[model samples]
Target chain A: MKCPQEFVFAANYLADMARSRSLEFFRGEIGAEVKADTSLVTIADRSVETMMRDAIREWFPDHGIVGEEFPVHNPDAEYQWVLDPIDGTYRFAAGHPQFGTLIALARHRKPILGVIDIPAMDERWSGAHGWPTVHIRQGRRSEVRTRSCTAVKDATVFFCSGIMWRNDPMAVWNGMHGVNRLLDGDSYSYGLLSSGFADVIVDSGMKPWDFMPIVPIIEGAGGRVTDWQGMPLTLDSGIEVVALGDPALLDDVLRRVSAA
Target chain B: MKCPQEFVFAANYLADMARSRSLEFFRGEIGAEVKADTSLVTIADRSVETMMRDAIREWFPDHGIVGEEFPVHNPDAEYQWVLDPIDGTYRFAAGHPQFGTLIALARHRKPILGVIDIPAMDERWSGAHGWPTVHIRQGRRSEVRTRSCTAVKDATVFFCSGIMWRNDPMAVWNGMHGVNRLLDGDSYSYGLLSSGFADVIVDSGMKPWDFMPIVPIIEGAGGRVTDWQGMPLTLDSGIEVVALGDPALLDDVLRRVSAA
Candidate 1:
């Protein structure tokens, strides 16, 4: 499935809208209200989600929505927008500037456009189905592609967070125990993967909004983002997402992290 | 022993000099020459270290020097300077902007003044005996303090990188394997701890220049920094370091990471 150029344009527009709203809360005293899951929610999250949802309603009323805050709107529409207004709220509430606003357009449950906008960092990574992935930082833009490194020992692997790893029932913690070059990071790690700086990224317990935008970015950058079983990511995909800059290392990475 | 106020002033001044020199290389195509230890070395590292050493020679000709890139100067002097021109060269070479220049003043083999200067981020953390720790970013400065959080479950722990945990002969990492709210970061993590935004930073295989500057900053902020064995950090301390915001958690934290 392919997204129209206008879809990518609209997704970035919606992302910019989210960016302006989220920027005001970064490094400031933004209060957080604990959500039902014991995760965090700040005004920036609610405000950005509401603003994006309204924009989608006005521009693409026929499209459905899946977001981290609030509800699912128009669940049966053929095209849908997936959003995670603040991707790393735990860090955001602590005034750390790595949190981001993610936007993606999916057709029939498959993402065709994705945008990861980090307002504080002034960086954005966006991709559409048939075009090269683009990374923008500090007003400069360049096409990006993942590198090809096959050996697991030479590969720099990353986990999403120590918090997620600590509670791993999937035993990924044990699976990755001895990987010498591993790192622990977040959406930023996925950004690095798409840009050839980092070779592999793995994480679990993510939502459709948490993992969808990254699918197009990495895939268009000539990498892979799949579940533990190597299935393509969709709204219905499992919580675990593994991204590799070098497609050749999938078997080696999978052999280690897929089973524990 | 207390260092004269001039020593702290000179340290920050030296850091600024190093910062101005290093800023030009950040995110640019700085050349790297691998060291015999298989770690990275960049022109930024050599240039900044040379500049700092020259400045120290001009200002305190009798002081000793120990730097990452060059040999000791004035080794028999009563006071010495420790410098790590670029502490995170691997990230710097990858165009990741978390690298920084560290400056510390040691008198009688103990650090009395320390500064961590992150040029690209435009952030700096500095501390001297008899004063509060300071964090500077975006042209604003604030006296920072570490918060007290006693329970391991309630604490927010951070690691310098997952790479350190991947090859843990000391096993402090296994002790921290399952605590909640862990962040993957570096010197920035220590700055956050000094600012009361985080607690509990653990890393091993550090050098004098790599770990010394952080000692005064955290201790001046009313926290603690020591080797994993719970010994106060000194020129002779082991490479493993554990920092905690609340002294109450020391026993609990030490029980796990302090031993193999």
Candidate 2:
């Protein structure tokens, strides 16, 4: 499906914000701040998210927006913009280049446009439902696809946070095995899967804003994404979901884990 | 606890070679090459390893060396150089800066020195036994420490690869679910933990060269490195291992997962 012009415009604007802010202090280090939740949040995160939100308000008057920072705005709307601001906040704070900015357009409950922009690493990946996912790194853009790894033994499976599994060890463990490798974090793993470097990503304890944008990118790149029970994931699907290179393997993983 | 001049000389020599070769390629975009094992390796990887091996031979005569690109010479030796050439080949080939070159000095199966030279990321972490592990990022060297996050929920655990869990879904599920969080790749995770950003790192698969260098670095930074069973992870230790900020929590996690 073609992404609406507004969505594309918003994504580009957000990408530019992410890139500019990332370059501003990327080589220069910054101190980290501990949030009320006790997790760390860098100043760049607040700055980046705020910039994106302001641009959104000017561009789309009626569109709802959900972001990691600030209050949730119009969560019940049919058309919404989800922003991670800076998905890899900790990495960014530590001066690692794995961090990025994530923006997505959701119509009703499903993601129709997704953009993952890693400024420090100089990579960008975006896609809309029915359109091929695209990966741009170091100034090159190409269509991306998932690797054809039918079994866990041949595939790489990742969970963004160990706590996601700790939060539900039984489900995480029961569902995955034979995976070729495991990675942590979200946008980057999804990007790797989209670009055929990995095969699966599963985790629990995520928000809608965290998982939504990733869906179209993964699915558009020839992958399947769902909850642990093999159900399609909507924005309301909670934080637990699995994205895999092959639908059949995804089912097998879900079946085994759910049964256990 | 100071690094001997000769050792430093060798490390810098290797680092120079690594940086020169890797920097040239890092300037331009490069694609991934699937190794014989179907694992990802890049052209920069081959170039870096070749340069390092050459430097080792030139700088330190009669010192046997082991690297990713070549077989070990005098595996059972008084002094042997162990090298990964590029530790995160997958990340490097994928254009992720989290990858780096790993070099360690082993004398009779015990690591006496270790260094992680991340040229593309512009950082280096190194330590020898009894010396405090120091982080050298962008030409600045600072001593590193592990954060004292005692509570399980308060801690950030690095679960290196979910694929390990997929291999033994039952075991990994039980093991990982007990941790607070899982980060990707033990090498980088251990580096983070050593520098106080993360608290624990657990992994099921590791080679001696992959893990040995990390041990001194972690222990030197006031942390514990052991088999998942809480046993010290000497070269002879099992592949499964855990590094923790606090011994009590480490024990609790190990017991919980082992029981599961």
Best by TM-score: 1
**Residue runs of model 1 more than 4 Å from their true location after superposition:** A30-44, A148-154, A162-180, A248-252, A255-260, B20-24, B30-44, B148-153, B162-180, B248-252, B255-260
User: Which tens-of-lDDT digit does each residue in B96-161 have in candidate 2?
Assistant: 567677888876667778887777767777877767788976678799876676666666666666
Count of clashes, each model: 0, 22
Using DockQ as the measure, the top candidate is 1
Root-mean-square deviation of Cα positions for candidate 2 versus the true structure, in angstroms: 5.3
lDDT of 1 at A104: 86
True contacts kept of each: 0.17, 0.15
Candidate 1, residue B216: Cα displacement in angstroms equals 1.8
Interface RMSD of each: 5.3, 4.6
DockQ of 1: 0.28
lDDT of 2 at A39: 32
Model 1, span A1-260: residue lDDT tens: 56698888898888888888887766554332221112334567898999999999999989999998888998888998998999887667655677789898889998888999988788999998997899998889999988777776666667665324344422665566544344455787788778877777878778899789998999999999888788899988977778898899888778877565
TM values, all candidates: 0.85, 0.75
Ten-residue region with minimum lDDT total, candidate 1 chain B: B29-38
